[model samples]
Target: MATLEGPDVQASDGESDDGEDIPPLGENDNIDAIVESIWVQMAFDIMYVSPNPKDHRKPAYVLLDQEARTSTTPATFQRSDLTGIFRSVLYRELTSSQWETVVFDSFFPLPNSAALKRQGFRAASYYKKWHHLMARLRRRDIVVVRNELRRQFRTLLWVPHPDTDRMWRTRSSMRGFTRLPASSTGPCPLIAINRQALQGTRITLNPPIDDVEQGEMDEEDF
Candidate 1:
């Protein structure tokens, strides 16, 4: 598998200005929160790739919750949780033919004749015309939707991993999830929760507190 390095942050003379002012990094803020916010804002979904039992070289996609955490202490992510970043980057960089092979042949093996029959496609006819059918559907159309996803993945993974402590780190960015000091014992509110997944109940990193207390806590933390 080819690995792509994260985007270069350095500005080049040929780069065009978007006219938006780059906000100065706030005091005590780290790169992790910024990247997480971007992912949340974009509503990117997470995916995991696992080797097929039938063939180790073939991979399969296992979708996962974007907000799910494997652990709370020194936060860690399952290999499956991080596959989204890898898939997105690979899809963006690979040629259409290569992408198709990766997705259909490896990630999702095409159904065999017996399986195709079960799915209601005439196995014989479908198999005979498979190449022609694929040729009719432009790979560009299928792959275009992934472009934004790939961009977001690259941005999130651009940050270098931070030194590990007891603090939870962002799975994708490999950095502390919050800028809170290691010594601070205050409960940090959960990053946004998935209400639907939790039976419609919300889980917050921090519990509700009085406005004055909240203000004071925010000041001290930041």
Candidate 2:
């Protein structure tokens, strides 16, 4: 997901061809699951590059969940296994082009001593991550991609961090960890670990692309 930008819209705008029997998926609640998130990242960014060769020109976006990167979606897919959980969600239909990903470890090996104790993750924290997301939705990279060899919009997937407990959860924002303030168009649609939304065949996530730049960033949470 390069500097994703241009026409970020509600999921309804993008069509879906997902299967009927894919297993359910959720957050990193099962932190000790045999499969590591890093491995899932590797699988999608590499192993699951492309298959049907759909419209490479189709714009796409990914929420890049901090905790549930691989819980349900099968990051790896074969030429014909379009029903894979991860593939189904991201590529709901044959979508997206090249892929690149970051690697992580169960031990959270980064020197950020807190990394080791990383069980699940808080919503938004880093300034760059927050800024980058809003910028993309607000058409940040539209001009550059237009000048280059791509379309004006990028197809994006709304992946949310799960709320392992309802006691601390509600229909939340779709902007990942960032609790972005209301834009000129008001707040983003309530998405996130809402089982009602996540388990549905389609979800509506609207990116109004408004005054996110002027909003405050709560960089300390989770």
Top-lDDT candidate index: 1
Residue range 44-156, candidate 1, lDDT tens digits:
21111111124444332222333432211112211113232221111012233433332223211221212222221222232223322222222342133234334333322
Clashes (backbone N, CA, C under 3 Å), per candidate, total 5, 12
In terms of TM-score, how similar is model 2 to the real structure?
0.18
Q: Flag regions of model 1 displaced more than 4 Å.
A: 1-139, 152-179, 186-222
Error of 2 at 106 (Å): 13
**Model 2 agreement with the true structure over 26-83: per-residue lDDT tens digits:** 2322312212333234234322221222345522222334343333343222212212
What is the Å distance of residue 6 in model 2 from its true position? 41
Model 2 regions more than 4 Å off = 1-37, 41-71, 74-110, 118-156, 162-222
Model 2: which ten-residue window has the lowest total lDDT?
99-108
What pairs collide in candidate 1? 188-205, 189-205, 189-206, 190-204, 190-205
